[model samples]
Target: MLRTNIFTAWIYRLQHTDLSSKHTAVIAELRILLIDENRQRAESLTSALNNSRYKISHLASPNISLLKQVDEIQPDIIVIDIESPSRDILESVSTLSNYNPKPVVMFSADQNTDTINQYIESGVSAYVVGDIQSERVKPILDAAVARFKAFQKLKVELSDTKQQLVSRNLIDQAKRLLMKKKNLSEDNAFKAMRKTAMDTGQKLEDVAKTLISLLNTI
Candidate 1:
């Protein structure tokens, strides 16, 4: 009977935890900057996106310095309508991706597959080719934003994982040193290390790193 009650409580907890995990707020309304050389085309694109959950801004010139304007607005996405790829525009996109959280999307009428691939590899998150339609713009924006957030989250998790692995390596090396220096069995050494960690109110990994550093100095 006790076992059955424990299982029921476990099931209840699992269901509620899964539901909580699914709840993430939709991204806030974004500021968007449209960069294109054609004034009419830029306006059309901006107009299409005006009613979106986005505040649209337009620039009719692809001047490299115009990126500073984007920084001031702190746009969530930068959409570049490229009639043709130029070195200056490519450099600007590369710089923006390295220095900012927001990702850039490149839309080209040229539809040159090789060029589009190059833009994507150069840090443009999404590459849309051909004429832009109002219906398609929002979905593309949504996907690019989602992809960028996922990449950022994965990067943070990877960094955390690397730190954990480094900590574990240090702990294991310290444990081995303790076994050899004290002429103690591995199990006994581990117990001593754990006890010391508890008494010092420090994490085992931290204690291990300190022990290893001390030994190295000696």
Candidate 2:
């Protein structure tokens, strides 16, 4: 009995250690899509992030086919080095955010509040306004990844909440239609819908949507 207990304790400790290790793992060796028009700045950034942990892919500027490149390369993160992030660039980044979201670290010379806000609203994760050193690159990237994770979590929660609200509205509308058309009480209306859903082996939302569509057609 004592040996079994010790073995159980050892297993628990191993699991606890593994959880800690996973937390530290955070982001893996990321495939970075580095965008910089200036050749000199690009070279400097390449040298700075020349570590085994990062596989850097370089792009000169935001082109018409930047989205195509993103689809193909599918980099974990995007690092942009530019004098001032243009409206065109910000729009392209926003497009990327909509389709395939990823952490974006933008280093720009312009310190204008409007530009900074635009970058953030457009989904740029880390916006460094001024010249940043090579030594600061890794830390900045790590921070961006962390922020992106938090933002993504918030987005998921918001989307779920919105979906729930829409589903509730749909069910309520369907119930109202049934009550008026069938001359049934509220509880009876609900039971009727539930029975239909169960009989058809369909989701409540799907059943509600179908009822609504039929009612609308009439």
Candidate 3:
């Protein structure tokens, strides 16, 4: 019974602990760009975040140069509150995703499935459909940042995989060319390419590309 009570107390402390406070300096330095069409709700949100130590810049709409604003401000995160997102807003968000690529958190009253999917496709890290309460803001933003980092890591891994596949194909093509033209065995051709790569202090992929370029011309 005593062990159970101690375990329960430890779990409660863990659940109630504010882990974000450990990174208070980092959190305090984050810049948040807020976009909301409704002034009243924007004010409410700003008030709720007043003590959160985040630097915020509010914009009424993305009708202006949204790209320029993002570039100039260079915010760490973007928070959008709207009833229903317009086509222009999605376009702007898409542009940001392509060029700027900041973590985006969207709060909307629109419960349509298509609209929610559109927002996600436009690079919104977190899409909340309901009222925006004061206590939910920080947690939502933290989740958005986490999701964005995870997505970026996945993208990099995919890109690396694609490059590796291309390089492997190039190396195979070069090896086959050597086997055919130089009358070398398959293993010997690969060894010759590897030796040239090491001697020239260049990548095997680069040497493969050079071999292909020269052998194709001959």
Which portions of model 3 miss their true places by more than 4 Å?
A: 1-28, 82-98, 111-123
- lDDT per residue, candidate 3, 135-199, as tens digits? 76665566566557667788789999999999999999999999999999999999999999999
Clashing pairs in 2: none
Q: Which segments of candidate 2 are over 4 A away from where they belong?
A: 1-22, 61-68, 83-90, 93-98, 110-123, 183-185, 213-218
TM-score of 1: 0.71
| Deviation (Å) of 3 in candidate 3 | 42
lDDT-better candidate, 1 vs 3: 3
If scored against the real structure, what TM-score would every candidate get?
A: 0.71, 0.69, 0.74
For model 1, residues 56-126, the per-residue Cα lDDT tens digits are 87766646557577667777887776444543554554565775656777776763532334333333456
lDDT (Cα, 0-100) at 83 in candidate 1: 49
Lowest summed lDDT over 10 consecutive residues: which window, candidate 3?
Answer: 1-10
**Considering only N, C-alpha and C atoms within 3 Å, which residue pairs clash in candidate 3?**
none
Q: Rate the local accuracy (lDDT) of all candidates.
A: 0.69, 0.71, 0.71
